[model samples]
Target: MKYLMEFEPIIKKSSSLSPHTFSGLAGVCEYLAEPRSKEELAALFKTCHTNKIPFRILGNGCNLLVRSAVVPGVVVKLTNPAFCGFENLGNTVRMGAGASIFSAISFCSQNNMAGFETLIGIPGTIGGALLSNTSDKSGPISRFVRKIEVIDSLGIIQIRDKEEISFSDKGNDLRDPVILSVEFAFEIDKTESIVKRLRKAWISRKIQLPLGVPYAGKIFKNPRGLTAASLMEQGGFQKTKVGGAEICDRDSNYIVIHPNAVVEDVLRLIEQVKQGIRERFNVDLELEITIW
Candidate 1:
């Protein structure tokens, strides 16, 4: 308690805990800390770790769901501009973990970086994308990740090369490390070519993903050879609503939450959808969104 009180000046209380996640869902957290620099972040991590304080890292929050109105621990957000920067090398780019996927794509297009054009429409920060192994038809973001820099619970910084890491459909095996930055490798291409690819990726996403809704990205990952969207459609989940949370008729994979929706409503709908899918297809769907 004394250690936590020491953060009284540096950390914000519940009233100031509004997160910038895409869902626009309000949550109640005890303490929220936004470190302006890596040194500050490390100091905070050190204190929390040494004192055994529970903490959760909050990224762009695009693919997250706040399941409980009152979160139990400290929330760490790295949205400071200092944590969001990019450096261009000849064939690779060093990107801060806080940088948005859109920003990375724009940089790639402008620099004629070819490989990442497929990531244009992905939401959230680079750190979130990497942690979730975000991908589309082309590939996962892990494919472009040459190296990752992270800080451990002890606030010790380390760098892991691609070979030293493993990523799967479940997500990256990051050992719960706080990602500092990622170095991405890309091929040189004509700026026009990169632009064309970026346009195509954007158009494809606009068509397949739900639009004009307050949602937390995808609800479930595709199960093996079957698509979650099609399964939801087949399971008769379209237009299904549990309180203010409803399955998007346009895209069965997305659950749109109304302004009045509570976390329980969203969670209940998810259970119903999952149960329906299990009964019909005999497949247990894995959730893609992080329930914080």
Candidate 2:
């Protein structure tokens, strides 16, 4: 419903490709995905199985950089309306995994929910955040998760409580469960203070991330006791470029997508950057963005 008014314009702006980055993304996904309830999701998966058709799940694509190469199967952008719902539960919030983290932070601030101020400018969905275990190793998104609802590959919906979910000290999730929704426990504080903190986070993000570019935020994850951005700068990989992909001079933490940059070009640059860093510092860089 709302997607018709909001995402269709974006769909039109982005041209379709044969085998794009996502296994099921861009033209193929945009044309086929129709968000529904759990039952509908199951039915859709059933249809895919019965027809011997292929399909895959995709979220906001914020953490994704799809290749120009395409995936043959049907693309599933989990836009299930139910997956976008946000509910207040005492000191917690139950949200659809599809709900944008940025939006969630704003809502929490408006409602005076604290503990999420640090996430104010982060652009991702609840599910993506959890899978990435977004954090600086002190804690992860799974740390705040009280429960997770997910649809397995079998198309069955299940919920995992906090105790059922566990994380590595390095901030990685052991489970490969496909998250459907999540219940986030939060601290309560004064609305004004939280809002102020949010503003501060936003300002910080604006300075660090290249907001106007088409690039995905972070290209590589920070290694133990080291920052990815810092490493890149040390080796002077900041000025490197592949096709139209370039390391943002303003912030080595981000890669800026020049006008008409293809997916392969971005991937090439990422590899080059990784190699450069390793050659100079002897550290293997881990990629942060999920290549679809």
Candidate 3:
């Protein structure tokens, strides 16, 4: 606890009680460290490593699921403005990992950048999106990422080009690296055209996905050529409920929680849905959200 005292000025105790996750559900955590810069993050990691204090990186928390049991160790969140800088290159846009996807999309629209319009309604920061391989049928984030900057396990900075990385259905194939920034490549287009395309994408998103609800985007990944939402709906999970967590009436892929929904309720509901899908369709479903 001595080293933790060193971070007292920037660390929040009992972070799990009021987690930053979109689910608004969490158990108590020992600490939450908010580092304002790359240097601060490195220092925090180094100290934690030396002290053997476990830690996990947190972003916009749009795709995370915290358990009901108290989480031991620190939860590190990169939220400082220093980690949200944006730069526009001729054919590339550079952004800090802490920058939100909405901000990036807005930047692209204003700068007449094309190819990222499909990512309009997605949540989470740039780093979280990259880590989750955020994308749709059009393409994954890997498609536009030209280069990625990260802090390795040893608290050292490193950069990897697009070709150097590998992506899978689960997400980007990162080997325990903490993403610091990303440079995305895009095509230049007319500002009007970009705005039109972005607007269309947003409208489509609003129609297909649930809005004004406390729900995690998608609970399961689409398997192969089939969509998970379709499978869930076909399996009759649309009106299913486990305690206060239930499948969204509008979007079968989303799981909406009531004001008093507990973490166990959501977990049980996910299990029930997955089991039903497997039993009915003989297809295994993989979860898209990270269960912490």
Candidate 4:
């Protein structure tokens, strides 16, 4: 009860919009604390930690879908603070975990940073992406990260300078740690050429991913040799609907949502598709969305 009060004012002004996952659709968080400065972040973390308050660090909320059940914890959102910006240093660039992936790409492009352009289609903050190892053939989180700075549950800060500081295959994004920033390596290139490529990449991403609807990106990972989307299509799961969730007709890969769609709909559809794919293809599809 007391913690609720401390988290109240902050919740009233947090961002709206939640994604879908195994759980049902949920309300916007009770509170959202957007700490822009390191001091603010420290204070927020210190206060919540000291009081034993429940909280989750959030990036853009693009990859998450909290259930409709009242969320009992506080959400910490990193805003457009200077602390989240990037700076060029030698062959690498330091990126604030709070910065949006889109912004990071732009920053890199303006500064002639390459490699990260392949992540142009990914939607989420750098922190979320890093935590999730957001990438594909371009390599997940390992290709660019030179070092990760994180704050542990005990509020102790640590820096891992080498690869293998991961939590899963392609390793962890230091998920358990509250990431502050990461240093990435990039090459020098023509600004005009970089921007041109970036623009093309963005357009391509739009075509590949269903961008017009409320989605948490792809819901499943392909089993080894096959693509999840292809499996769903082969299983005839396209345009399928449960509640507010519907297999996007525009693309077999997406779960299109209506304004009234609840969390259950998406969850149901995903499960159905998964079961169907497994039964038909004999391959279990792994879910990509993190559900809580």
In the range 1-292, model 3's lDDT, one tens digit per residue, is 8887877888988766445888788777788888878888888887887788887888887887888476778888778887898998777889999999999888888888887877888888999999888886577888889999988888888898888889865686787558999999888899888888888888888887766767865688889898888898888789698888989877787888789888899899989988888889999999888877
Q: For each candidate, what is the lDDT?
A: 0.82, 0.67, 0.83, 0.70
- Ranking, lDDT, top scorer first: 3, 1, 4, 2
Cα lDDT tens digits, model 1, 1-292, are 5787756766877743334677777577878887888877887788888877777888888888887777776788878887789999766799998988888888888888888788776778988888989878887878888988888757988888989888876687788458989999988899988888888888887887646667855889888888899999988899899999889887888878788887788889999989988888899999998887
Question: Each model's TM-score, in the order given?
Answer: 0.92, 0.83, 0.94, 0.84
Q: Compare candidates 2 and 3 on lDDT and give the better one.
A: 3
TM-score of model 2 relative to the true fold?
Answer: 0.83
Order by TM-score, highest first: 3, 1, 4, 2
Largest TM-score belongs to which candidate?
3
Residue pairs in clash, model 3: none
Candidate 1, which ten residues in sequence have the lowest lDDT sum? 15-24
Model 2 global lDDT (CA atoms, 0 to 1):
0.67
Return the top candidate by lDDT: 3
lDDT of 4 by residue, 3-113 (tens): 446445445543453432312245666566666566556666767788876667877666566664555456776774644788888778889888888888878876777
Give me the runs in candidate 3 sitting further than 4 Å from their true place.
16-19
Evaluated at residue 64, the lDDT of candidate 4 is 68
